[model samples]
Target: MSYQDRRSPDPLRRRRRTTPRQRALLELLKRDNHFRSAQQWHAELRTTVGVGLTSVYRILHQFAEQHVVETQRAEDGELLYRLRDTAEHYHNLLCRICGRAERFTLDALEHHTEHVARQYRYADVNHHLDLYGTCPDCAGVAQQE
Candidate 1:
């Protein structure tokens, strides 16, 4: 049999019973560029997708558990979620002034982490790095003054 035929059907797909709220949440995440908090998502869903706040939160948690989405703490300490599939890699650059976030590849950062791990004789080491700086807009404003 072909690979498609040999593989079992997706459980969620087979049910034809997936929640509309969950689908709507996925759709919203797919369209947005930045990560958003549960409250922000709920507001957007209510205005655009007609989904309720409770349903949005429930679906977000489900998505987070499945690794379909990722959560991060914003500068103000609010939890935000973004679709994982759309992210090429996961490293953050934080703007000190405006508190905006930018995601970039982690190649150089990973290399440094590996070097540190080897120096420390670590069996395995994983690290998260967030670089903080004034973003271009903020830097430009600073320069103008």
Candidate 2:
């Protein structure tokens, strides 16, 4: 099927236009909090949805462009993807090994950002916080080896 044909025909639909495969992928990501690679997503999807790897990669890139998901680079330089949180702003501590993430909010950081922006007379400022490191579980496992 062609890309244009995958879009919703209904003009009244309020949500962003997405293909059936894209919707399925979003649902899967909604249930999983950890970042996962396109290969992993495609592997899981194949068991039920039978989507092609190219389709998975295309849909993931589209989702990322639409701000429906976030992307990060792993230590090995592979790209990882996960659904974005609904909160206005937050930080994520990502595990380098497992792609697990811990979400956090800090008032001081927000205040500091605002203070700095105001000092510099900046307007329409935005930020994305993603701190990457080994989570405690991964750290423990590494220490054991």
Candidate 3:
């Protein structure tokens, strides 16, 4: 099938109008508490907002494109989606063993990022760094065991 055929029918495709379902999806993503799968989000919509799966996907894609939510692929290759914090900067540390994630910021790392970008002659550089190691709690648990 063609790409247009794959997409849902849009009568007001020319006009950008936010439906109630879209608003609910945006609000749900803005809460920023837990990671949710598409299926889980669909169930929540059914119980709470009465939106369909197709609408959920469409709204989610819109939100992701607009930076309303952030999407990441987990170590197991699952596409996980989370709400984006507009006010806070985001960086992640990953536990290579347990696939756990932590957030942190360091002024030294920020300076290094800028320095490397400048040295490499990169323009408009934005970077993401994911440090991989066992977390302190995990290391302690391993030692105790």
Candidate 4:
């Protein structure tokens, strides 16, 4: 009930501003165009920001749903995320260790899928195709080891 108590900020509480955190997470993503698990992103963010792990997962989920980021499954089935390179539908050749990606499109595959869908009378058919390998830089590093 003291007059000065209400005017002072709460020292024990950590402020969590939504927009800044979201933008900070985004800035982190922009630093590299490489896919990583949410846990990985959170661990990296911890060194630079005060974002919580739950917030990291939630923000990444929101970005995925909005198509602000692209996601793919790693070899062990963990979901990986990266900033989307384009608005169009496409696939990528991903590097398993380094997360490097090269976006690609296959017209023959698309046509074959469409034909198969029509043959089976399936509507709204879609597909996901990704190739995983080691990029040259990672391979060279491995060779040196």
Q: Which candidate number maximizes lDDT?
A: 4
Each model's total of backbone clashes = 0, 0, 0, 0
Ranking by TM-score: 4, 2, 1, 3
In model 3, which regions exceed 4 Å deviation? 1-17, 30-32, 93-102, 131-145
Quote model 1's TM-score: 0.64
Each model's lDDT = 0.66, 0.73, 0.61, 0.76
**Candidate 1, after superposition: displacement of residue 57 in Å?**
2.4
What is the alpha-carbon lDDT for the whole of candidate 1? 0.66
Model 1, position 64, has a per-residue lDDT of 66
lDDT tens readout by residue for model 1, 28-133: 8878746678988898888767777788788878876555666766667776777664423466676656545677766787788779889998975665565667
What TM-score would you give candidate 3 relative to the actual structure?
A: 0.58
TM per candidate comes to: 0.64, 0.68, 0.58, 0.81
- Which pairs of residues clash in candidate 1, taking residues 3 or more apart in a chain or in different chains? none
Residue by residue across 58-144, what tens digits does model 4's lDDT show? 998887765567788887889999876455666878899988888778899889988999999998877778788999898886544
lDDT of 2 by residue, 5-75 (tens): 12333322335776788778888988887888899889877877979999999988887665667776666
Candidate of highest TM-score: 4
Q: Which 10-residue span in candidate 4 carries the lowest summed lDDT?
A: 1-10
